[model samples]
Target chain A: MSTTGGAGSTALVTGASYGIGADIARALAARGHDLVLVARSAGPLGRLAAALETEYGITARPLTADLSTEAGLEAAAGAGLGLSFERTAWEEERRMLALNVVAPSRLVHAALPGMLGRGRGRILNVSSVAATAPVWLGTSYGASKAYALALTESLARTRRVRRSPVALTALVLGHTVSEFHERAGIPPSPPSLTLGSPYVAERAVRAILRRRPPVVCVPSVRYRVLAGLLGHLPHRIAALPPLADDFTVTSYGAPQPSYGTGEPPAGGPESAGGDGQDGVLPAEAHGQRERQP
Target chain B: MSTTGGAGSTALVTGASYGIGADIARALAARGHDLVLVARSAGPLGRLAAALETEYGITARPLTADLSTEAGLEAAAGAGLGLSFERTAWEEERRMLALNVVAPSRLVHAALPGMLGRGRGRILNVSSVAATAPVWLGTSYGASKAYALALTESLARTRRVRRSPVALTALVLGHTVSEFHERAGIPPSPPSLTLGSPYVAERAVRAILRRRPPVVCVPSVRYRVLAGLLGHLPHRIAALPPLADDFTVTSYGAPQPSYGTGEPPAGGPESAGGDGQDGVLPAEAHGQRERQP
Candidate 1:
């Protein structure tokens, strides 16, 4: 982007407390753009905003909201779009949909008109490579990402016909070094699958401001290729993608041996799918402790 | 599938009041399996159950419950699996996730144990070809189906390891003759793109019962081929799929040039994806209310 038109415009960044979202915020700030940072944690968001403001001399405002409830969505809609969900917990899954799918949509609905009215706006919806071809054991998360990508394209197409200059891009990402895996109770990503969060953010930022961005932009050249390949594969995604080694539910209700005692992985075509199924497992009951959607 | 083992076993079917679900129930009755037919409407479910029971000389039970809520899911737990959702309505979308995604997972989670202990069980999760590759404009509907497919595969994998003998299959379908489109207010499906719901059910029943049934089974041979091709294509599905023309938001909040003067389709690569600048565009929001869950 040309610094002239980019500066002074307000950008809204969700999941801005850390990782890719924070880096995107920093990249936006570097272009002299003011920002509204959104995330569940207040302290981290505030600190990130302060750091960006101090470093780039741009105003940065922080808003803490759980992007996973109707009210949170209204607050954020009035708001990356990250994804997380549980197999056993439907309520958690509901909130997961709220955060990953609904929140981005509502935010886009809320932000785009203003951007269009102002004559320039950029909406970058962060999605996953998994959307192209789902990873094993990643039901709600991958599906939700797919929803994000399709909706982004749908809106982009909707606006394109009107010759609206406003831009919408789905930032399709691969495994990045972030808190995602840790939060999901999965092991850390191996080196080969790990893409640096900063690198992903920088590329995403550039694409969003390009003269004409593709409807979907996968960050790294390698990830882009992988995305294409995954999309080509049929439903039988035999093995886990490099980034998805930890994506499967290895140990669910019980701690199963993920590695071999000569045993295949828990859900590895052997260990029986039920986590003691009876009538809505008590652990997965509605009022159970749900994940932070 | 031996007559000895299949005889007298109870079969549970959801969305059984109409379309494929009803057909599947009929097919199950033909196979001599007693039935538990579920749907949102009680009258139709009861009538279908009665008709099937009388024709096939088997017992049938009707259960009417909206499987789109926590209470509904809990009520339907230990039940059948089917999916549907809308793109624009958050309320509908939320319920879609609950029904298409939540209901299936919970049903499987509930039924799997008893199926395992009995050493003989069959779960046929009805998904769509759209899940293999999403048709444009069908956002949440497609995503929820993808979730159903992945989660089904996940649990199937989990059980395969234990030599549990319980069988799970995803019935991947194509556009079929049904009330889905009429209810959604979209025009009827074109003949070339349409498949008969009875044909779909018959095939689904065969595949689910056959030894070594595929984890994901597309009903018709042509649909199977089409499903394969869709899976092969990366995103940027060049044109709106044959099934996708009506998938776009046709009526939002106001009147737009739909038929004449040829305004490119409402979501025709522009309009920035239905941020719904105005109200009830007639092209999408309500008359466009569509589903086939």
Candidate 2:
């Protein structure tokens, strides 16, 4: 690891309380970077901060705020930003826009100038595989992610126009084992999604620091291949817009069924609800029914 | 022409006073869709509304409002919508987000459900070719277009999830001959930008009405081929995140220099100053400079 940060090198990571974000925090801490960990809930963030500090001997401070509201942006601006997800309702849509789209932009807006002045900075925005195209979900989530990728692209360009190499990388991730879906009350993505989260953090950090760096990085060889194919697939065939298991038009207050791995479990339809518990529909799962056409 | 709207087919167009947006309003009026022409200024919009009403015999209402504000969205919500843009300023960036990103999403939010209920409707959002990847522009315009395209993609999926074929088409436009650059105080893209605005409007309406329309329609044949290639080009190569002309990093208040169509202009840099009355960079005017290799 080039370990970009020196004795006092500091990093700001949002959504640091859990899942892929938590793993990223651990990884960064190992790299000897002091961290300002941001998330909504204080308990988990606090616990994670303590653990990281104790384990890696790096300073970790947890800040609890929504990150989607004006106050959230202000707080995050004072600190710095992770990202990711969904639901309906105008309220839900608004929240998704603020968190997934606005917050990250604001956080980056805040932290970027300093890095540019110093002539070296790295920003890793966590986006989903679903961001590349549309998926069958509420209208806002994927769009929000698309906003992130676009923002990162624009900012990176902004830096480049000035000949600044302060890097901004979009981590176009495939599904992984994170509390992401489960915490929202939806089923977990089927195992077919990815090997798991440990690999994601390790690969993401590596990609962000590569010599030429990257505009976007899809971890896991399988997903890298899939992302490449998806890019080339005819737009019509490649995109599978809004649909859930029962073919219901999921909208405000609809039952949101997550897609699972396509292979039917030995226990039949009884095994794969995507919940990692029950109601499994392996064949339809294809593991990626959510995004794959 | 399937001129779908009769009793209430009022097509509200933002930025309707000039450029591609004005052309679209003209085309829609020609197709028998009543028009609600919107722009920041009333004079031009009023004149166009009168002219369209006189020429096409369709109702044209000129509604002047700053679409970057809440009041603007409220006014547009009461009417219906269309879109288009360029430029930069902190205020300009906010307005760009409001118009290009927020406005379209809001307009769609206001108009979509009603269309789905009727089992038909057409939404054509004007986005840029630059949106496919990043360009060297130092602003929010490209990112906002990205937001529009992603929103359209998700909404298209939403309707499909319900099996409702409400048409949603993202017009992925290339640089066209319009007052766009002039209005922004920048030189016109060399004629190579694409066949200009007249083609842009006519082709856009047609694409939105195709029996099997595409999620994104790059208006010209050349651009369509290019968009296809971009989708397949290695992501690293497809996106060139920095620089317009000099390897200088342009900024908010800095003097903005115009990039020629990648060739030395015949009249030298002097002939390319932006206005129609002066420097015309047409023959050598490839609207966009290919990313400096």
Candidate 3:
């Protein structure tokens, strides 16, 4: 922790009411940064903001808005939230574009001038490994993430050319222990394949501080290699019967759910239907309950 | 070559008045398939329809409507044009998505059942290589292409599950000798890097006939390898100074004259502009032209 001018650093995080976004908010708050948390759920955002202020002695403001809509983005930015980078909407396909592509972009546009004037700022867009690989099941989600990565790269290039201290980093993440899977109505898998919440949070904060442009593949390096290899293989080879089946979520556990109609859990506007739980753990949990099953 | 059911086969081609779409229409017509040509410009479409009727003895119906708007798509489909997937979007990013993603999807939704009932149909979507790789300058354009590829894959997967002979192929093309460059206000580079219009048309038609999943890096084996490698590389590594330049078009040369801001070109959308006006020639001859200047 470099403390040169660290007392008043501020960060804004979107989708901060729950999941990876919430965890990232906590991690950044713990690092002595004042926080502005944005999410659609007012209840959860308020709870998390109170908790962060109590635990970290950092100023935490809870902002409720749907970052996917243009109006929502305007309200979030107009609240005078200073952030190193905005991280929100880790999942949810439709909102993924709104939150990941449009919202982050609008926020960045709002923050750029301030950061440039201050001469040193970091912007980390939390993208997923799915962005790089063609995941059949999450087509919209993956495409939005791909756009996020591309946008990050473009901004970084612009910064480099202008010799600006404003840094843009795209943290291409892997499967992490978060409420993401539960929201999607899918049980988490084994720990070896997934990451713990604390681990993901810490790594994300550190990368933001370091301004690293990383395509982070957690737990296993093999996935990174596999994602790369799969992208190159011919469409026929990549879309083999076995591979396609593996990519799709065929069953949640018997009593086969409807193919594409039913809503998910984690009740919100887009919820497919289970319970609206705050933090539902994966099916099999090991050492830490926060780890992805 | 395979005349199994050629006589009654109907192909619906969007933006078929000129360029690659027109060439594709011609190729399919030559193979004895009836055609439905769709474009915003009625004049060129009408001319092409007449020419195809005269030259190949295939019925060519000209249905002029902007495929980007919902109303436009409805009108075109309602006109009772033949069904074939010869869809391509020439310019304007948002329109590209509307035409390429929304309209075609709706059209497919309307036409798929009949094709499935007959147990035979070929749908070919013309997507540029830019779909897989991000183009810095053409952000929206690239995103739209990405959507097309994803949609194609999804449709193909769905069709497979129903055991339908409806084949959806995404032709991931590279640079080709078309008017696209001129319209884009960019000078043409070496012709070896570009395929002639006829060559692309022939290869694309052949691939569609076979119902290939997605054609990538057409005419150049090298581009296939390149696209594969780029897709796999980490964002940081991929964002290195040298590679970024190639991925983005930094500046436009000069704006070409257009008839109207929102209107499609005279004969459908003119393909990207290029220098040579000689009608489609062999790829080798085009290569010779490149070496000259």
Candidate 2 chain B lowest-lDDT run of ten? B277-286
Candidate ranking under lDDT, highest first, comes to 1, 2, 3
TM match of model 2 to true structure: 0.75
TM-score for each predicted model, relative to the true structure: 0.74, 0.75, 0.69
Task: Pick the winner on DockQ between candidates 2 and 3.
Answer: 2
lDDT of 2 at A159: 35
lDDT of 2 at A153: 65
Q: What is the TM-score of chain A alone in each candidate?
A: 0.75, 0.73, 0.69
For candidate 3 chain A, which ten residues in a row score worst on lDDT? Answer: A77-86
For residues B1-293, could you state the per-residue lDDT of candidate 3 as single tens digits? 12233455667776566556677778878888787776667787789899999999988887776654646764221110000001112223234334444454455445544455556666555454545543332133343445445545544553242355455555665565645555445455346557666677777677656533232324457557655665567755655544433222245443332322654321111134211111111100000000010
Give the distance in Å from residue B59's predicted Cα in candidate 1 to where it truly belongs: 2.4
Candidate 1 C-alpha lDDT tens digits along A128-159: 66566645333344555666666566556542
Residue range B240-265, candidate 1, lDDT tens digits:
54434423345533222221221211
Query: Highest lDDT: which candidate?
Result: 1
Better of 1 and 3 by lDDT: 1
Per-residue lDDT tens digits for candidate 2, residues A1-293, read: 12243434666666565555666667777777777776666777888899988998988877776554667663321110011112223433444455555555555555555565666667776565556765433354455566667766666554352366566677776656534344333354566654565577667766665554576767888778766665556545655431121112433233332222211111000111111110000000000001110
- Recovered share of real interface contacts in candidate 3: 0.06
Query: For each candidate, what is the lDDT?
Result: 0.50, 0.49, 0.46
